[model samples]
Target: MPTARIYQRPKNAMQSGKARTDRWQLEYEPAEPQRPDPLTGWAGSGDTRGQIRLGFPTMEAAVAYAEREGVAYTVVPAPTKTLKLQSYADNFK
Candidate 1:
């Protein structure tokens, strides 16, 4: 049986904007460990399912799709966001 994980997309660390972070993503767990190719010396795996990522607008939709497809999935809760509220003037202090 193929195992999958459903989770909310996290904000990219490269940018401050949170675009597309509201969506949930479904990804399959790797069936086998990756190995370095003998000729190219590049890490590769025979399981192509690891490259597949399905996105849904909501967590419920992602879960529904997993159930409908008979895919065993686990929901990974999104991390909580915390903001340190500070004013520009505080820097002077």
Candidate 2:
């Protein structure tokens, strides 16, 4: 006599690491790095265009700042500012 065996799908698949990874990819896989806006956040000269600052959030924003400010931006400034505005409104006073 011969016996046959059957395989069942895993019930735990949904909670598995692969499933988590898949969910992450499906929900919010990160985008390619972009030039970030420096002014939008708490950094730089309230200039939307700024060089790639490690802390501001993105590189695109930095470059835009350079272009807008007419800075020598063959390269991005490393988040360096001399007497950089503590806040954008500081200049208004």
Candidate 3:
């Protein structure tokens, strides 16, 4: 069976606002291996799985779609950030 993944999109490191964190993504795991092209002598672009990223507004919606499509998927939770907010003046302390 082809395997898939359902996961919440983590906030980009440079992102200060929570614009994209609320969206979840569904992606398939690559079933092929990267092979070198004989003609070009360069590694062929075989990471086709990441070419399609299905985004949903909620995690439940993402999961539901995967189930409805009969896709075997594993949910990967987003990493939690526990940093306390600090002020610029706190640096002086």
Among these predictions, the greatest TM-score belongs to: 1
lDDT of 3 at 82: 87
Please say which candidate is ahead in TM-score: 1 or 3: 1
Estimate the Cα RMSD of every predicted model relative to the unseen true structure: 0.7, 27.2, 2.2
Worst 10 residues of 3 by lDDT: 43-52
Per model, state how many residue pairs clash: 0, 14, 0
Task: For each candidate in the order shown, give its overall lDDT on alpha carbons.
Answer: 0.97, 0.33, 0.84
Tens digits of per-residue lDDT, candidate 2, 8-84, equal 12225446332322111001112233544666753334332233222222345544544565544343223322454
Query: How would you encode candidate 1's per-residue C-alpha lDDT over 1-93 as one tens digit per residue?
Result: 899999999899999999999999999999999999999999999999999999999999999999999999999999999999999999999
Which pairs clash (backbone N, Cα, C closer than 3 Å) in model 3? none
Of 2 and 3, the candidate ahead on lDDT is 3
Q: Candidates sorted by lDDT, descending order?
A: 1, 3, 2
Error of 3 at 72 (Å): 0.5
Pairs with steric clashes in candidate 1? none
User: Candidate 1, after superposition: displacement of residue 37 in Å?
Assistant: 0.5
Candidate 1 shows a clash count of 0
lDDT of 2 at 64: 55
What TM-score does each of the candidates earn? 0.96, 0.22, 0.79
Sliding window of 10 residues with minimal summed lDDT for model 2: 20-29
